[model samples]
Target: MDGERLFCDIALAARIERAEARLIAESSGAARARRGDSVGFARPFAGGVASFAEADSPFDKVAGLGFAGVPDAAELDEIERAFAELGAPVQIELCQLADAAVGAFLTGRGYRLESYENVLGRRVGDATFPDGVRYCRDDELETWLAEVADAFAVADTEGLPSHEEFPRGTVIDAMRDMAGVLRFVAERDGDFAGGASFRVTDGIAQFTGAATVPVHRRRGVQTALLRARLAVAAEAGCDIAVVTTQPGSKSQQNVQRQGFDLLYARAILVKGTSAISSSGADSRQAS
Candidate 1:
């Protein structure tokens, strides 16, 4: 397939995964809204009108204010108004397929291209992982969550929700409700060390929430988890596997080391004068 078409497919699949996460959040009684490709969710739930734990996984965000083929300046104005209504400075991530008109409208209204992420993709193949990686059992979710929370805290301690959210009051409770998504964790000396999540839809699988505790960094914990998830995706008949990471990040290096190719760089655009104001409080990259 062509580059633009492939990127769109990846984007759509990512959005579908995101929408599913939001729907699950709403089903779990969290407040959220969906409009085409755009979804708005409430705070502390992981998926909401105000996202607290932003990741590279497609569904890791809370809302999309402008990247819905919405080339109309008038509608763009309405979107800004909606952002104001929500009372959170939501970001809109878009690929190269986005029309110049959309970019122009967002820019004219004070939107800034603050950062970009690389969306990498590759066809399914053999799934080989290092020893010690294993799937998370239903009964072991709490342990897994705690370990992940610890790992994430090490990555960005301030961005995570208080221990009172869900699945110990973190949004992971809603994630556990998602279909076709599986969790894998690594163990060292029989203690949870690192882990990752896989979300499969329309023959595409995405690796998400990969984390390794501070004590486990650079010790092949994530590499093993990644291969395990890819193998699972391939065994399930997936045609493509995708992962997103910040440009020049160590996580990006990990995926590339696993043979994932550079698909496209998705731009994370922020609107309003408060653009990036939430970075210190909400910015945390995925593994």
Candidate 2:
């Protein structure tokens, strides 16, 4: 593999490890809440790790799964069958380093791919922010959402998904659910200019939804938002702040200018399924 591809592979492995750790933590919490014993990571003989958290019933909830070291077709088949039996839509993340046949296998099984993003990161350092910007926590969800919606209007273009269509509410809820969230916004002249949301985990703060208003573009709004978020992450003992963007997009250039390096690119595939029936009690809480 070339240097870039090698870098992507390394980054993918690290990301998978980080996600698995988070999954374990979440599963343990869920199990404890129900007063049930937690399940351990199950290593398939073929090569991959799978963990399931019981949801107060026999119905299995796939907490996390990842394949590495060139998994065989049988391994993929086993994974699909296991997840299908759970009666819930399973979420699987396949990095670019994954074997080409993996995508074909998933497609053959009616798994439609959706969404893509590039993971970016930078070490914490001194960053100058535009004057008058302020940082806030989850309390400012509505204000942050509004600024995000406006920024989306400016960032999106023809042939792309509109802000109305994207689930901004769901994103906000997810960020709130995750601990260590640091949300910030830049306001100038009593008007919102830019905003960003991030969560620190395992000493790495992942930055998401950083955007600037249309009229505020090129006015250092985004830069200020990023700088403020990074400072917050650093104060919280995070070693680095990571972000993702579309390849070759203006956002990518902006992040690069802010000293973030392109660690890797991964396609986010999302398949919509019909509503699932559940025998287990609805223990999952709404975000």
Best by TM-score: 1
CA error at residue 67 for candidate 2, angstroms? 5.3
- Stretches off by above 4 angstroms in model 2 are 1-13, 16-91, 98-115, 128-130, 137-139, 158-164, 270-287
lDDT of 2 by residue, 1-287 (tens): 11122233555545644653463445334443444553432333223344344322211222222344444658656765655564435444455655566566656667655544456777765545447678765577777766565455344331222111223443433333333456677887888777776766677776755777777777777777777777777677776667756556666677777777777555543333423222111111000
Q: TM-scores of the models, in the given order?
A: 0.70, 0.63
lDDT (tens digit, per residue) of candidate 1 on 173-212: 4344334568888888887778777877567776655778
TM-score of 1: 0.70
CA-lDDT, candidates in order: 0.56, 0.52
Clashes of 2: 3
lDDT of 1: 0.56
lDDT of 2 at 86: 49
Question: Which whole-number lDDT from 0 to 100 does residue 274 have in model 1?
Answer: 37
